[model samples]
Target: MRSPFRRPASRSARSTGVVRVDTRTKRLTKRLQPGEIAVIDHTDLDRVAAESLVERRPAAVLNAAPSVSGRYPNLGPGILIEAGIPLIDDLGPDIMRLHDGQRVEIHDGAVSHMGKTQVIAEGTLQSAESVDAAMEEAKAGLAVQLEAFAANTMEYMRGEWDLLLNGVGMPALRTQMSGKHVLVVVRGYSYKEDLKALRPYIREYRPIIIGVDGGADAVLEEGLKLHMVVGDMDSVSDKALTSGAEIIVHGYRDGRAPGLSRVEDLGVEHSVFSATGTSEDIAMLMADEAGAEIIVALGTHATLLEFLDKGRSGMSSTFLTRLKVGGRLIDAKGVSQLYRTRISGWWLVGLALAGLLALATAIMSTPGGQAFLGLSGVLWDDIINFFRALVGLSPQSPTV
Candidate 1:
């Protein structure tokens, strides 16, 4: 009689916890604690943001913007619902007024202060069925989104013609990437899994490791020293900046570099790479310009769905950049699968056993070999007899 996607009436369908509010979901994720209510202003939430929230195990997610908005079936809302976290959306800008650490109650799409009687605000409580319907609607809008994507791509190309076509404005880095394998890591998709999978490739090739923003933390988290950190410097931690990686701030072509001041304040030396795309785009551009022999990309978006999931028109740079670097570019997932450990432990053991067997065969085929074998057998028997006698047992006659 009732929809299965909706929570059952028997179970309490309310979330009560302290709220963590931020318009930037990436920055907010850094401080989100378990059971905390995340109050974000994200629209068409992407997979990476959803994954960060899932990792924090939030009590609920309250978005001031539409989670789907018919914007090409964004993956964030479905991830939250699948993780069993309640999602309340379209709460409007008024919800951002909620202060951090303010205890609140969320019930039936309404938010109320803890122990208060009046609802502060109400929103659409999204469930599995609602998200599914939204995704279908979003998919239909793909044609319109594609048209916009094409237009934006042309605009980006026109505006940054020199950079795209001629590789102009690329920063000169001390980290030598010429004729070497370069690993460019971005904090998107199944980055953790991809990074773990590339451990062997990373060890074997010892590629120049480059981390984009929070990806720097991902690198350091895995106990790897980052050779370079390239981004706007908004999402990366101070520890990552001080990690001794050459920090290259991604700046606008208009010369406005907001992230530079933060680096200056922290007293970390950095250079600015004036570009017109995402950090990952500039990272690849840098690698290509530096003449990297092979570029291994980890946690980067490579598909149309992934580009749309990022919710940015500037992803055109990624499309164009990939066209330029696609020859050398290999997805970390592919490398992990194709790469075999050059020397497997089992292979080594088998080779050792075969060598001993060959030696034994050669020894059995010769007179000198037979004499040596006989002496070895006699010595082994004598050693066993000596051990047996020391244990207070009468030794039996040695084998003939």
Candidate 2:
């Protein structure tokens, strides 16, 4: 009588707490210190949070991940429990409607309908060991998803996403009008940090900024001006919807466009590009084809881990696509290596005061900082001297 995903009205009355899923396990482990929730698209990798139980443990994990492509074991929640972290799966559609610091309750999952709660973590959930890995994963996942997504979700991915590389297997931006550079911004992924790092470069180079749907919203949130947007229109904000950036909806081969309709509903100017690749990738191709000398990536994904999480065929597609635009493809991961935050000189002064207090307190105490007291000091020093004298004299070496 009712759709499964859309919980009926009557059920809401008895709902004790909302049940959510953990999508990005890896990110959850890296980002959540303790007492934080994990929200994301999907999960198939060993999560960092799980391994941290022996070291930097967290309180619980709230997974926003899809269970087995909409079915099956949903290993994410179970794994969290094994790692000493409570996990919940599938909070429901449109869960992002909740703000960053919003308080809410979760019920069900490995944690016996996981108790009520609130999220306390700060920043994107991803914690890649290296930028290079993140990039490979992001690019590969997008590529695979785009190829298959072309045939099935052509209408939605294209129109809303400005993604043209559908079944055709290339970024529409690569084929069409070429006039400006396209800057892509991805949130949650390590890409966001990359984007921030490359801000100076983007500003100096003056490449046209193209936000990937919600990425557009992220840039604007930071007060950065965007020239275009690409991606499925699902996650983008109302402000991005109304922003004056040029909108080109990526569509299916049949010519259906979701983003176009939404824009038309509000009577906004929009175009369509139907093909077979990700909105982010398409943005790069578009900028390159548009006659831009360089296409620098910000907050972009191109890593093995990222691809696996995308839950689609991305590895091959990303490889081929990048080959199509080799030298021009520059991933801006850790571009901010040289930019260090100025340490407050006052911070050191505070530390000096703390040291003084500890020293004074220890002097007046009976134990007198016994933890710092050395044992067998002269014996240890003599042993060290003997070792130093014999250091370079190997048993088989010639007499020196």
Candidate 2 lDDT (Cα, 0 to 1): 0.50
Model 1 weakest lDDT span, ten residues long: 2-11
lDDT score of residue 300 within candidate 1: 92
Model 2: runs farther than 4 Å from truth? Answer: 1-85, 89-181, 254-256, 338-400
TM-scores, in order shown?
0.88, 0.50
Q: TM-score winner among the candidates?
A: 1
Best by lDDT: 1
Give the Å shift of residue 107 in candidate 2: 8.6
Q: Which 10-residue window in model 2 sums to the lowest lDDT?
A: 5-14
Root-mean-square deviation of candidate 1: 5.7
Candidate 1: what lDDT? 0.88
| Candidate 1 structure quality by residue, lDDT tens digits, 1-400 | 2223343221137668999999999999999999899999999999999999999998889999998888687888878887888889899988999999999988888999999979888899888778877887778888988998898888888888788779777777889999999999999888988898788788778999999988888999999869999999888899999989999999987888878999999998889998888999999999999999999999998998899899988997899889988899998888988765467667899999999999899889999998888898889989998999899988878767
Computed on alpha carbons, the lDDT of every model, listed in order, comes to: 0.88, 0.50
